[model samples]
Target chain A: MNTKELIKANNDKRKLLTKETQKYYEDMLIYIRLSYDKSEHETEEILTEMLDHLLEAQEDGKTAVDVFGENPKQYADDIIGELPKIVTKKRIKYMGMGILYFLAALAILSALFNVVEHYLLDLNELTYKIYLGTQIANLMIAIPIAFLQLIVILHYLRWETFKNINKVLAFFIYWIFGLTSIGLFFVIIYFMPSFGPLIEWNVWFNLIIGVVLYVLARSVKSFI
Target chain B: MSLRTQLLKGILEGCILAVIEKQVVYGYELSLKLQHFGLEVSEGSIYPVLLRLQKENLIKGKMKKSPSGPNRKYYYLTDEGQEALEDFRHNWEWVKQPVDQLLDRRDNL
Candidate 1:
């Protein structure tokens, strides 16, 4: 079966597992499934087989812990050791989509602010020129930083080693990081030399670009 | 790990290859086959070995519609797997005799 099919079958089959067993199994499941650079298709194939095997073992009175041994992470690592990595084509596709999506979000937010100020507050800056530095800050510094952060976050989530931290504390950590990145964005833009060719921020045009890019990102997700 | 499990780690792939050589098997069924033949490890342990064998091109898996429940991934021996099994047999014969002779507690008794 294909990767998506295997994943669907896996989700459906996992309902057969007991709650505690499922908890343990799914922790390993999500961890393995999101692991960086792993082959998507092969990983799903094996994970599906793993769920099936675990269910079969459960029939024989074995829990996930029993079937996978005490260290489920170690077992998962062993299995992951042999799975192939994603091809370069898919990797490039994701990276491209990420860049476009990031740009689209910035444009959309700027459009919203412009629209609100002009139409609602009667401010006449709807067609004001956008600074070139903002574009560079976003594309050069912010986009790359966001993608790097995404990679790290995905890695951390899959590791799940943060279970020792309190849930509230983890949320706070994420919140603080979000604030820090935003702070960094402003700091960079402030220091950016504001001299460049005039680039107008036409609200209607940006909104259209944002919608087009939003559509593009959605379509890009359907590629793989 | 016990010395027994440590030793099994090296040879388990061969044992699994031997099992698949006999007939097509899925992960769970292969684990049961190993248990039936007296290997007392976790049933999940076979998956790593299966993955490794597949990586080495010794075996390949196919998704099949099982008679009951989920679509099981069934594995069968490849041409390389058959050759590897034969080599394992030869190597087992060669290695087993001397190890058996050395480890035979009956002689000490």
Candidate 2:
């Protein structure tokens, strides 16, 4: 009740923290180590906080370890729960890159069909010239789109990016949509001389489809 | 003091320091010596602490490839660690004196 009693009580209680509590602190350090990679300062800060918690729990008689141990796998299960859905850093970036590649392939294939349609169908000279240009331009556009796709894939697979899924999604959405729209705009501009007013509608339609497809792909990647 | 348990640990540290001062020794052999001295520590606990201590510069470590399983890390005490062991020995002597006196006095009473 008095100061000496309190001091003795505190000292005695300190002895009660138990080996299990120390094990809990050790387990926490292991958790931090597994979740993070190669930052000594971060590791040290985490350890210090864990030690403080262990000391406090020793005094309080209620360690977090106690709560966790009541269910043997509960601690591991909680960490497993904390994990960002099964989506890996590689997979998310792959989704973004994969979608962009598919779009590029689609555009190329479409332009090819147009070329064949014009020549084989005996279309007018002006239309044939424009279709030929469309095929050439679509092939040209594919190069940069492919490179951007590779960059996104590399960035996504990097150790830092792999830890978080949302960042990968954000980067892919930004680049894939941006690049594909630009590619389509160029395609339209290249054909503007022949298609004239029809070119504007083509641009908007392609842009809308690209955006819709990107969103659907990202949503699916997050789940699957 | 619960540090009573830590006394054997102190001796283990000294033995490790002495051995490593001579040549690098792998974990399994080091653990075997400690167990031979009747310090029943687990293999897992020993290596992790050795790694941590090595990181702290109390010791130095390097890995050698093994034909089986993974490579093994061999740890040796640093000059700084030997100096630390001397300080630990001096402090431990003083700390033990009073505890010894207290135990002796209880029997006399």
Q: What is the lDDT of residue A194 in candidate 2?
A: 36
Name the 10 consecutive residues with the lowest summed lDDT in model 2 chain A.
A195-204
Q: For each candidate, report its DockQ versus the true two-chain complex.
A: 0.80, 0.02
lDDT of 1 by residue, B1-109 (tens): 7999777876898899888888898888899899999978778888888888888899999988887855788999999999988998898999998889889988763
In model 2, state the lDDT of residue A97: 58
Native contacts recovered, each model: 0.87, 0.00
Root-mean-square deviation (CA) per prediction: 2.4, 18.3
Query: How do the residues A93-205 of candidate 2 rate in per-residue lDDT, one tens digit apiece?
Result: 65565665577456545555555655799653323123445544555566566667556544444423323358678787778867876786576556644322232123334
Off by over 4 Å in 2: A1-33, A39-224, B1-19, B65-71, B105-109
Q: Summarize candidate 1's per-residue lDDT along A1-224 as a digit string, tens digits.
A: 78777878788888989998998888888878777788788888888888888888788898887888888778788888878788999988888888889879987998898888888999877777877755665568877778787887887776655255788988997898789878877887777776667687678888899889988998998996
